[model samples]
Target: MAETNSSDTRILMFPWFAFGHMTPFLHLANKLARKGYRITFAAPRKAINQLEPLNLFPDFISFHPVTVPSVTGLPPGAETASDIPISLSRFLATAIDLTIDQLKSLIKSISPKLIIFDTAHWIPQVAKPLGIKTMCFKVVSASSIALVLVPARNIPTDRPVTVEDLASPPPGYPSSSVVLRGKELQTLLFVTNPFGDGLTFHERITMSMKNSDVLAMRTCHEVEGNLCDYIGSQYQKRILLTGPVLPEESKSTLEERWGNWLARFEPGSVVFCAFGSQIILEKTQFRELVLGFELTGLPFLMAVKPPAGTTTIEEALPEGFEERVKGRGVVWGGWVQQPLMLAHPSVGCFVNHCGFGSMWESLMSDCQIVLAPHLGDQILNTKLLADELEVAVEVKREENGWIPKENLSEAIKLVMDKDSEVGKLLKENHNKWREIINPKLVNEYVDKFVQSLHEVVG
Candidate 1:
C-alpha cells in the first residue's frame, strides 16, 4: 500500500470493452503498479466496476471511466462486448471510436509518457500529435494474432466467403495453416461486415497494429515462440512479450454456494467446464455437451448461461436431463470464481472454449484440458494447444464441423483417464507448463518490459 515516489513513471491503459480484454490489462496494471509505476486504467463504467474488487494495488493504480457514446442498434446501456451478441461487436467497436475525443481529453489531463491501448485503433492517432508514445497491447494468443495478421487470398465481392476460403491458409504466409470451422467459421462471415461498419475486423486490427509504436502480447515465447517471431517479422515492429500476464493466485475464500458443492467430489474426480462470458450455445449443441458429460460417468461442474433467446438453463436443457444426473452434476447458471474452481483439488480436467485466458489458467492448474473452442481466436488457440502444445485435445467434429455427443464424450474420457497414452501426456505437459509459467518467469518478463519502456521513451 505504499505510495509511489515522485519520480514514478505514469502509465495510461485503455483496454477493449470485454471481460477477457480487461482482465489481462488489469493484471499488467497491477504488476506495473507494484513496481512503483503510477498507472491510470480506463474503461467503461461497467468494466471499471468489475475491476474494482480486484484492484489489489489501489495506492498507485487509479481507475478512469469513459462514457461509451451510444450507437443505434447497440442495446441501451450495454457498456461492454459481453452484454451484446457477437454480431453487434462491430457496432461496439464504432461506439468505442466515438469516445476518441473524451480519451484525448484524458490523455491531455494526465499527460502520460506512454499509453497502452488494446484493439482501440484510434489511440495511436490521438497520441502521436501530443508526442506521447502508444503501445498496442494484444490480450489474445500470439498465434491468433499471427493467423489474423497473415495475408490471405482476397474473396470475390460478389458472394459471401465460404468455409473453404477460410480453411485454406493464406498463400505464402509464414505459419502452418489453421482456420475456423463450423459455427466459428460462420461467425467469420458476420465479422467481415459487422453492422455494415465498412472496415472489417482484420482491417481494424491492422490499423491498430500500424498505429502503435510497439506490440505487446499477453503470452511468452516459451509457449508461442514461432508465432511471436512471425508476428514481429511480418509487422516489422518491436514486440514486447509479457509472459502470459496470468491472474494472481487467489487467496480469498470461495463463496459458500460453490464451496459447498465442490467439497462433495473426490480429489481429481470432477470435470470443470466453462465457456466464458460471451458464448451462448444452441439447444442442440447444449444438449450434446450435457450428454457428453453424462457419458463420462464422472462428476462434473459446468458454469454457463442460457443460450441466446432462452430465459433459463432449464429452457435449454433436454427434458429429464437434470433429474438423470442430479447427484453427479451441477450446472451453475451465472459467474463463479474461475481461478478458484480450476485450482480446486477435485477438478481433474477443464472442458473449455479454449480462449487464451482459460487455456493459460488450465495449463497453470495442472489439469488436463478438453477443448471445445467456440469462436474468434478460439479455433486458433485450440490448434496451439491440441496441435502445438499436446496438452489438450479438441472435441471430435463432423465433416461439416458439428460436434456429436459421442465425440465430446470420447475427448473428455481421453483426458481424464490418466492410464491412457494421451491422458498421461496431457498431465505431464500440464505439469511441465506449470513450471514454465511460474510467477518468477512472469516477473522476469515484466522487468524486461520495464527496461524496454525506459529505452523507448527516454
Candidate 2:
C-alpha cells in the first residue's frame, strides 16, 4: 500500500441505512470536512435529499447516491430502516448487503485512503484487497458494545443465545450497572436472529469490529473510558474516541411558531419531550405519556409520531385530552428542532427515549434529563446516564416493560422540583459533565482521530 497525504486524503462514509446512524456519521463527516478532508458520503437517493440540508461543509463533502436493490418482503421504495418496522430490518439489511458490488465499484473509482462504516461488516474484505484502510465507527454507546457484542459471548453457537444467557454480564465486562433484566432481556432477541443473508445482528457488529483496521466510537474517554478499554482488550485492535461529535451550532433560529409559543412560558418552566424518528408508541402508551405530562401541570411541547394504526396524533389522543391541555401543552406529530428547543430559555426539562443522539443532546443541554429508553442500546444508555453517571433519572417500568403515567410524572418532578434533593444532585453531576465535554475537548478528540486515520492509511 502507498502512503496517503494527510492534507488531501479522501474518506468514504457508509453508515447503516438508518437516519440515526447516518446523522451521526454526518456529524463526524462535518468535523472531518471542516479540517479540509474530502468526504464522499453514500446513501440511498431519497436519504441523500433529506441529509443535504444538514451538510454543513458541502464544499468539502459530497453525497453519493447508491441504488438499493429490490428485495422481496421489503416495502417498495424502502431504502432505509425508518421506512419500515423493526421486524423488517433484516430484509433491509439484506438489501444493504446486496449493494456490496455497487460499493466496490465506488471504492475502486474513488480510491479513498480510508472508509468509515458501521454494520456493513464486509467492508474490510472489500477494502483490504484494494489497499484502503477500513474503520468500524460505531454510533452506539461503548457500554452497549462492551456488554453484549464482545467475543466472549461465543456467537454463532450451535444453539441460539437465550434471553437468560443475556441477562448476566459477559466475562470481564466492565460494568455491573448496565445489566438487562425482566422484559428488557427480550430486546436481545434480534442479536440471535438472522439480520442479513446469513448473519445475525450480533455477528454483523462483532464482525465489523473484528475486521476493521481501526475501531472508533462517538464517545469520550472521560465518560466511558473503562468500557472503551475493555473493548480494546477484547478485540485486540486500536480504539479511537470521538467526543460526542455534536452538531455545529446552527445559524438558523428555531421555527417561528415553536419559538413564539415557547416564549409564552417562564424561563426554566416548560417541559420539552421528543422521541427520535424510530419509536412509534402504541395508543395506550401514547395516552399514558401525554397524561403524565398533564399530571405535571407544566407547559410542555411534545414531538412524536402518532400511535401504531393511528394516522394522526389527534385521532389517538385521549377523550377531552386536547381540550384540557390546550393552553398549556401540545402533542405534535412532526419533526422539531430538538437542539434549539433544548436551548430555549423556557425549557427546563427534557423527556427523551435516550437514543445515542438524544443522549448527547440531553447531556449538552441545561435541561433536567429524564430517560425512557425503548431499544437494547437505548436501555443500556439509560443505565449509563441514570444509574452509572448519576446525571439523570429513568422512569420506573413495570415487570412487563410498561411505564406507568404516575411513574413518568414522578421521574420528571424528581428533576424539575425545586426542593427535591435528587434533582439537585443530578443537576450538579450533569453540570460537571457538561463542563468536561466542552468544545475544546471535542476538538482535541477529532484532531487525534484524524491523525489516527492517517497513520492507519499509511
Candidate 3:
C-alpha cells in the first residue's frame, strides 16, 4: 500500500449476500463515496442489484460483479442472495471455488488498499493468501454478536430457539433487546464450516476476526457501548460504531407515503405487520396471522408472500379477510418500499421478526413493537426488543415455540390499548431514538469510515 492522505484510500468491500448484510454496508459505501474514497463494491450480481443505481450516479463508487457457482445442494437457479436453502457447507465451497479467480482479477485491476468483507465463516480463504488486509464488517449489532458467541451446549438443539434462553443475560457483554436463535447457533456450531481450505469453518472465522485490524459494527453507541467495547477488547480490534444503514428511502417521500396511510386512519390507529424477506410462514400459521390481524379491528398493512402459482394478493388470502379489511387493510405480496410504510403516521405499532433492518426502521419510526423473531440470533433480538428495551411487546408463543393466533391477537391488542401504560413509553423512547438516528448523521459516519480507510491505505 502506498502512503497517501485520508482522501486516497481505495477500499473493496464484500458484503454478505443477504438484505441485512447489504443494507448497512451500502450506507457505509455511500458515506465513503461522498468522502472521496474509491469503492469497488463486489458481490454476486443479484446480491447487489439495489446498489447499482447509486454507482451510476457517483464516480467514487463502482459495482464489481462476481458469479456465484452452482452448488449441488442448493435449489436450482439459486442466486447468491436467494432465500432458498442451500447446504451451507456445499454452497460456500462451490461459490468460493468459482469466484476466487474472478476476485483475483478484480483485485489486480483495482488494487484496493483495504478489503473489508462480510464475516461469513466460509469466506476467509480467498483473502488470506493474497496478502489483502481484511477487516471484519460484522453487519449485526455487538449484543447480537455476543449472543451468537454463546457455546453450542447451552442451546436446546432439538427445536427452535426460544425467548426464554434469549431473556437471560450472557456474560461478557451488556444486555441487548435481541437474543440468539437456532440460526446463529447453527452457524456458530457448524462442525464443517467452509471458510478454510477443507476444515471446519467457525473456528476459522473466529481466528480471522481475532486478528483483524478493524471491526465495523452496525450499532449506535447509545444502546450498545458496553457490548461493543467488550467485543473490541476480546478481538483486539479497533471499534467503529456505525449506526444502522437504513434502505435508501427519502424522509420527505417517507413522510409523504406515510401521510397517505395516515389519511385512512385516526391518530394511533393502525398496526403494521411484516417479516423480513427471508421468512416464509407455513400455510396454516400464515392464515392464522392474517385472521388475527383481522380480529384486531385495527387498520393494517401486511407484506406477505404470494402463494404458489398466484400473482395477486387476493388469491393468497382467506375468503372475506381481504374484503372485510379492504381499504382498511392492504396486502402486498412484496412491496418495493418498506421504510416508507414504517415511517407512516398511522402505523402505531409493528409485528416483526426482529431482523436488524426491520427492527431499526421500526424504532426509527417511533412505533411500538410486537416481536416474532425467527432463526439465527433473532431469538435474542426478539427478547431484547420486547422485554428489556421496554419499547415493544413480545408475541406469545406455543409450547412448540411458534407464535399462535390467539396470542398474536392478544399481543396486538395489548400494545395498542389506549390505556395500556407500556404503549406510551414505548412510543416515547422510540421517538427519542429516531431523533438520534437521523439519516444525515449516519451518513456522515459512513463517509468518515471510508475516508479513514483511505488515509490508512494511502
Best-performing candidate as measured by TM-score:
2
Report the CA-based lDDT of candidate 3 relative to the real structure: 0.66
Better of 1 and 3 by lDDT: 1
RMSD of each: 2.4, 2.6, 4.9
TM-score of each: 0.93, 0.97, 0.83
Query: 1-458 in candidate 3: lDDT tens per residue?
Result: 21233364578877766666766676677666655667888877776676565442256677887777776665665655445633443464455556667777887888776787764443345555666667778776566666544232144545655555544545655554344444344433442334435534444445556655667778777667777787776666677766776655553355455467667787667888888766766666777788888888888878767643555667668887777887787776764456766666677778888887777777777677888876555665666566666677778667566667788888888879878777777777767767777877777766566555644455
User: How does candidate 2 score on lDDT?
Assistant: 0.90
lDDT of 1 by residue, 1-458 (tens): 53344338889999989999999899888777777788899899988888988888898889999998889889999999899887788889889888888888998899999899877887888989988999998988887777655444354456876766666555545566355545556644543564225677766777788779998888888988777787787778889988877766666978887778878989898998999989888778888888888889999988998876787887788889899999889777789889888877888888999888998887777678999887768888888888777788999778666789899889989888868998998788877877878889888998898778777667
Q: How many residue pairs clash per model? A: 0, 0, 19
How close to the true structure is residue 456 of candidate 3, measured as C-alpha lDDT? 48
**In model 3, where do residues sit more than 4 Å from their true spots?**
1-6, 54-57, 86-94, 120-131, 150-201, 247-262, 307-313, 435-455
Worst 10 residues of 3 by lDDT: 187-196
lDDT of each: 0.81, 0.90, 0.66
Ranking by lDDT: 2, 1, 3
Ranking of candidates on TM-score, top first: 2, 1, 3
Best-performing candidate as measured by lDDT: 2
Count of clashes in candidate 3: 19
Report the C-alpha lDDT of model 2 over 1-458, residue by residue, as the tens digit: 11233267799999999999999999898888877789999999999998998899787889999999999989999998888878889999999999999999999899999999999889999999888889999999998899888898765478767787787778888788888778887886657878888888888999999999989999999999999999999999989998898988888899999999999999999999998988889899999999999999889999999989999999999999999998899999998999999999999999999999999999999999999998888999999999988999999988888889999999988899999999999999999999999889988999899787768877
